[model samples]
Target: MSTGSLTGRVALVTGAGRGIGREIAIGLAAEGMAVGLVGRTHGTLSDTLKECVKRGSRGVAVTADVCRPGSVREAVRLVERDLGPIDLLVNNAGQVDAAEVPVWETDPTQWWRVVETNLRGPYNLLRCVLPGMVARRSGRVLNLNSGFAVRPDGHYTAYATSKGALLQLSDNIADSLARYGVVVLDISPGAVATDMTAGMPMFRDNRTWASIPYMVAVTVDVARGRFDGLHGRFVHAERDDLAELVEQAEEIRRTDARTLRLRPYKDDDPMV
Candidate 1:
């Protein structure tokens, strides 16, 4: 599918109120897709919808917490009622640790809150949205993942662990939906300068930040089916050479190169 092919398709974007989510919603609208902007804040979601409308696309702003299954179900109902059956779903709502502290020092409640927002939120969305997609046998789901998922971070354990689980979630769903003609992908925006990232100490002195437009462009490309061959793999907007990755898609599939896995102790290891 090309950008033109996305015209009139419906998309539901969680966290569409601000940052990368807002930009992605606008990008899809610019391509002529009707978008459903889902977020907790009505004001921000409304602003996003206005931006979408300015691009000559239809949109609806629905305030709902993605962490709650019931709320997600209602949100999905409203979006589909206003736009139509969702062709694309973007799970982008997430949170980070309150402070850079070791797991032992982190508040258990706070830790679980972050985990629920980042992991359970996407699971709720998938539960509410996938049924229609599976029935139709045509849709795409994009889980906003992170590099931390593959690397260890002592201070951001909750964030890292949640993202890692989300990666596995995408992989599992992709395998299940493969024969159904549905696509699932895990995309990492690569430390973009957002309100969320501004609070991170690691990025405070960093000179380079990921490009919002670049990430949005990559998202639009994925929505256009440019990277469907890489379904279930992790795509990092900042680090990846997308075209080259597409060229190597078959090789990637054969090797299971991008999905999460455990490394064997040696060549003779049974796990291998």
Candidate 2:
């Protein structure tokens, strides 16, 4: 928190072409951090990269499918070669289920695609770039998450299952990487208006949307190392107060709040 601005930090945001990812990139750049844009589409990536440059910060866009290992590694190489070592990684790239369906009624390929993109995408990015963070003993990672991770959704089975799995991934990484000066978090941006949610019947109009500023603020805090103590926890922008959450770090740790866990089934369940 000593540094007022993210002036010298470098951030890589996947799915940086549109929606929340684009906003995060531009917001970080406005704070004076150079940004590296990654996504599958070259045109949108260029557009976002241009927007970041307009914020008085440098940026580079590297096209890559996060689900592909070779491509993800190549992205890291290109970004580091131009933007310097990435100090922060915003794993914002994600996919929505092609069609909302019950688990038994889902198309197998489409279901797997959702899981692969949402879960394996981050896994690939971490496998590629985490080693550098460990070697330097410093870095921060924020996984774009969703309330569905913890809440059961009858219709959005694939998306919910993937996010639920990702929450545990964040917890595991946070525990393993904290001693290396690396912090990891799962930040749910709430009900943001984005292409992924554009077709949802519940959001037929332009109302009941989460504030973009709220999501951006949380990202900035993570980038600035302001909430390192809340590492490995789930942060829901719609319900949790960031300031208050940070203050309750001790209690959170004690109670194991903001993480996925199993119910004891019975108070005396020793196996649990």
Candidate 3:
């Protein structure tokens, strides 16, 4: 890819105020993508916008609830007005209500909230933004997934279910839109050190892993078409050991199935 591969490209990232989302947005900006930052928190959005501006990328912040269609629509309009047409979308906004409640004791409202933010939020954004991408015949959609999407813990039914659905959602969209030049991917970054994980019981386990910057880097690389051939696949940071993680993802795409597990390439023990 050229040095200016992402130059002039507009990207919208939801839940971009802190942690993984913040890192993803900042990484994209550093790669020359104009960014639209979305979050419910004004202060956090300000911080993220500041980081993007510091990297010399044009950025605008939108305060909206990802669960609400009207709110997402308004945010998209504001972003288009300020940053031009969106060339990429990172559906990163989500919640974890079920992570804290037992499956039997979980309230219907909380379960729905998680499903809404993790699954429906992406659907909302895609419904609003996909037309533009399809019309242009060039765009990228990258959604965040969790390790639990494949191997769930005891009580995170809502999160795990939603993420699993998101994986299929990405695959279906990519398949339907592949001819249009738009790409979709579901990426699980492993156990990233974020506010979400800092307090989780898993963080105390010997299996605890540090967050890798490759995930954020690859997200930008995907948007810039550095890994165009990898569309419709799932990627993980552990592939960093074999080659550029994104490149490995592309090679995996050439095989029969779109789903690829990345742990085998890592140097560590399989149990680790």
lDDT of candidate 2 vs native? 0.89
> How many residue pairs of model 2 clash at the backbone?
0
Q: Which candidate, 2 or 3, has the higher lDDT?
A: 2
Tens digits of per-residue lDDT, candidate 2, 1-272, equal 22339998899999999999999998899889999999999999999989888888899999999999999999999999998998999999988776666788988898899899999999999998899999999999999999999999988888899999999998877777988989888889898988887777656775888987779877987898988888899989888888899899989988998889887989898866
Candidate 3 backbone collisions, by pair = none
Candidate 1 Cα errors over 4 Å, as ranges: 1-5
Candidate 2 Cα errors over 4 Å, as ranges: 1-4
Point out the worst 10-residue segment of candidate 1 by lDDT.
1-10
TM-score, one value per model: 0.97, 0.96, 0.86
**Root-mean-square deviation of Cα positions for candidate 2 versus the true structure, in angstroms:** 1.9
lDDT of each: 0.92, 0.89, 0.82
RMSD of each: 1.6, 1.9, 6.1
lDDT of 1 by residue, 181-201 (tens): 999999899989899997798
- Please rank every candidate by TM-score, starting with the best: 1, 2, 3
Clashing pairs in 2: none
- Candidate 3 residue runs with Cα over 4 Å from true position: 1-5, 98-102, 205-208, 239-255, 260-272
Candidate closest to the true structure, highest TM-score: 1
